[model samples]
Target: MLSALRKYLILPKLIRLSWSAPKNRTVAWDRYWAGIARTGARSDVLWDSGTDHELLAYRDVLRRHFDPSLPIVDVGCGHGAFSRALTAYSPRVLGVDVSPHAVARASGESAGVEGVSYLARDMTGPGAGAGLVGSTDANVFVRGVLHVLDAANQAALMENLRQLVGARGTVFLAETNFQGNPVEYVSHLGASLRSIPAPLELAIRKLPMPGHFGPEELARAMPKDRWTLVEDGAATIETNPLMDAAGNSRVPGYFAVLKAKDPDAGR
Candidate 1:
């Protein structure tokens, strides 16, 4: 009875909190990243165990698919961690973010790194990158960014990315899917409720951000004719302790590889 109540009652409330979240996602994330920068903490620390593992997996995928000679763009590159990682494969890497503090920190921390640059710009805007649009082949990397935006902004960003990449471009995306696993969902929900204070928890619900989405939700959000889902799968990055007893330990998330559908359609 208790389990059923929690699943049917508490779970629905938690899900509703995400659905009705605020819409100013970009600004909220900018402030959040700025705050993190001010605290002198590396942005990589914000990644959970599952995310870290997924990143490693993605790196392997990148090594296989990435053309070493072409330039790579790291969209929503928070602190240049992924950009620096990409440097190992491609000499030319550009990291861009909307947060000035994050850009400053990334630039300062990676000052000595060669062939890698950081910029503070909103990729969704018209005047995002000067002289960057047609300078390189479109092979963009986006991690934990899409879900932060509302539907309109997400669509706009996708359109912008498609434009930046031009024809025959590829987009590698890593995002959290709350509907991936039941055990993982319950575990995360319990942890969040415990870690956050009551008032702050309420505030989070009102924050202008799409907390997370399911795999289907994400798939539906993509422009069908503009983008083709080439590859996708669950992120078995970590084990769920709650499901250990059942010998099922995989946590929930997803990664996808999308290609421009028409290659020359947007151009």
Candidate 2:
């Protein structure tokens, strides 16, 4: 009964924060990560998908843009899943997340993994990537991050990505492009009062409600004058919960490959 009441109280807060003005969401994400870590069930997170196949499906698409010699930064890399997979190609991989607890958890899980490291840094602030500026020529990989940020925060993140990639490196981002009302969307993903997927519940009850990111959003976030979009297309974002008879749970997604335009090259 107490648990039910607690959940009842959380949903309203979630709705409020979802529409609130964009600010530093480091606290919210930190809280969410801490909570998730306490659950001790890592594979059940909504975005985990519990398989490397998710990244495998995009490996070919990414191979066309990533420079194998360059270090890869997996931004918003919760638990370092993709960071580990990236080691198959890149000699060095850095998994960065806004939550320190998340970084610790990922580091703990990836203890013996060679060529992989983790950092906790918030990319949604001005001058966020100053420490990483020297990581020039480093490629970036972001999945399911942009849709959780508003335009202002998105632009800030893009600036940080620009700084990290420098001149020659590229960035690959994949974001959910869900197009439905929040209630309908959650319901379709298998949420209910009786039983909600832990990760989805955590997102709805704590983190910012997700938004959409498609071609237009990409154009706005990384304008052609400053960034070049090398490639883009439709994709599917797999989830860990709510499998159907086909044994899969997925959502509409979009992926883009981009490179920062050099200021000196044009002259």
Candidate 3:
């Protein structure tokens, strides 16, 4: 009875408070993630049960597209889940993130895991791409990070990836779409709602959320002069039985594969 009351009644109030909350997104995310680090929790623990599907989808993409012999760089890799996963195939995988706590936790968790390492570095900073510059065979993988950045930061990130991957390298990006239908929105929200207690979820939701972009907007955001889109399509992160207007299943996220137009142009 109390659970029902909190879910139906108290939840609405908390959601409202979350909308009105005044918090800097970067600071809030750092602090929130710091708490996760201290607890030594796996990043997936924050998501609903179905997040495993998304992880599987990512693994599938990697298997089909990623070259095992080439170095792999995972940008904005929180807690190094995918980075650690890549160690099975690649001899060199570097996961970089802006959060020191996240990097430290990831490094500690994956310590002695051959072929994988974690670094605390902001992709947007000057010379941040220096280490990976001119690696024509490298691949840069970014997921669940771009939508959170502003335009300038996003551009900087792309530039960094371009440098890391070089002219012939490839880039894979996965991001949530803000223009999803009501069902899609609910599906995305349900992940958090199911995993977190009602009141706490509500409080967390009130904090500043990340930005979302439609497919066209994402295409426009890419640096056309440097990268050429190879493939892009709707991706289902969670199974939804419902169909959209086009009779296709609704998905909460999307993915893109881009190749450098000129691998040796800016070097």
lDDT of 2 by residue, 1-267 (tens): 775344454455446545543344777778777767532224446787767777988999878889898899899998787888899879899889989988988888888999999888887767666665354568999999999889988988998788778787889999999887666566557655556566676676666667889998998898788798898999888877443323436888999999888723322
lDDT by residue (180-224, candidate 1, tens digit) is 343235444342333433322343454443356546656666768
Output the lDDT of residue 262, model 3.
75
Q: Is candidate 2 or candidate 3 better by lDDT?
A: 2
> All models: lDDT?
0.62, 0.77, 0.63
Candidate 3: what lDDT?
0.63
Q: Order candidates by TM-score, high to low.
A: 2, 3, 1
Q: Pick the candidate with the highest lDDT.
A: 2
List ranges where model 3 is wrong by over 4 Å: 1-25, 37-52, 132-137, 178-188, 191-207, 238-251, 265-267
Candidate 3 lDDT by residue in tens digits, 1-267: 674334343345445546754476555555555666222222222322212456577776667777777888889887777777767657888899887877887798787889888888888876587765233468888877787787778877777676777754678888767575332343334422334333234325533555675467565667678778877877654322221223232346788888877756544
Candidate with top TM-score is 2
Which residue pairs collide in model 3, if any? 18-206, 167-263
> Which stretch of 10 consecutive residues in model 1 shows the poorest summed lDDT?
37-46
Candidates' TM-scores? 0.73, 0.85, 0.74
